[model samples]
Target: MKIAPNSRVLITGGASGLGLALVLQFVERGARVLATDVHEEIPDSLRGLEGVSYLTLNVTQDVDWAKARDWVTETWDGLDYLFNNAGVAAGGRIELSEMDQWQWIVDINLLGVARGCRTFTPLMKEQGSGHIINTASAAGLIHPPRMTEYVAVKAGVVAISESLFHELKPYGVKVSVICPTFFKTNLTESLRGKDEQANKSAAKLIDKAKLSADTIAARVIRGIEKDRHIILTDRDGKVAYAAKRFARPLYYSMMKKASFQMAKKD
Candidate 1:
């Protein structure tokens, strides 16, 4: 599970945010990397990096996975790590979200990770060594109010990653799940234009919350080196998880109180 200097790695959704941070870190660590996003135009800064390459990938499609696999096999001869980090964001309570919104987010966030594992894990298994990293969320561990669909999908990611970890162990593949409270990323944009009023209100609340992308990336790299099963990016995340585990009734009571306050205001 150690990512050696010359390891070949592929990352989905590497065009920006956390994926971009991972690509930068790995490239600096001496890994040869191929990154992809559904969006065209890889960032100019990353274009000239010697050991890194970029491509357009729509992770929801089987054909896209095939092309990514072909590209890595042709370029690197084999793959050492497949980071299933591509994701989309959605904002709204379950009842408020449109059906298409639910479908779109789940397809891209949850099922996309599943598809990546399905198509690429075998390639690594055949080679006798590889790693799979799935990006879940702190929301995955606890279903907070107002993020029903997102929380559910992320929870599924954690479950899928844990299952893959055990299943892939027989094949010498490793699986890790990342759960961060909130890091500065384009995921927030998923709510953009969906519901401007509610989004602005949420934005104000988020602006008061403090977390950094650079810090999260650093932690993730370290976690990967250690082959951690569940990588937590924030101190608050660890604390929150522990609190929820040992004090379930208190946690629910506090959450219910907060919900009542919000409702009373509404």
Candidate 2:
């Protein structure tokens, strides 16, 4: 699953954040990149990039995915990499979360990946070589409070990627799940929650995150090159993941403490 020069790559949510970083990197590496987002207009930074095309794609819609697949087939004849990076952030306790919010988050964050996989996997299988990189979150690996909807959907993304990794390995297609901590991204701007104070606290946490989206993108590229299944970007994310794996009770305790502190801040 080496991303060589002229490799055809498709990235969702490519207008900003991690997706934009990936688009820049892939284009710099001589890969032909199609960067898709829900926005009707391409971002100013990516508008004139060489080896890159901007397209409108709403990941939650089946028709949008079909159009993307057709575009790839007609333009590149095949796709070598599919990055399921489009997602939105939502927060709130599970008990306080509304069904509409859950549906919206699930549609974009979880089922979006599923739709991309279903649409592009066959093309990858036919070509005999491809890779799918899904963007989960550190929250997916470690349960943090006040982000129940986001965590649940991201956990689903991780689970889907794991299943795909095993199922697609024998077929020359690699699958990797990226579980990264907060970074300088517009994800916070899209945050949906009823608790204004909790949202403010979450935004503060994001502002304090050390890694940038570019750093996360670098790790993602490395993960792809090495075919690493679980890609963790930040040190905190890696450490938290390990804690959750080997010290579940400790991890839970820490999360509960953090949750209580956030509530106090609110």
Predicted structure with the largest TM-score when compared to the true one: 2
Which portions of model 1 show Cα errors greater than 4 Å?
A: 192-198, 205-209
lDDT of each residue in 171-208, candidate 2, tens digit only = 88889999998888888888887877767867887888
Error of 1 at 153 (Å): 0.7
* Residue-wise C-alpha lDDT for candidate 1, range 2-120, written one tens digit per residue: 56898888989887788888888888889888988887787775788878888888989998889998898887888888889998777654456788888888899999999999988
lDDT (C-alpha) at residue 255 in model 2: 85
lDDT of 2: 0.89
lDDT of 2 at 84: 98
Cα lDDT for residue 8, candidate 1: 89
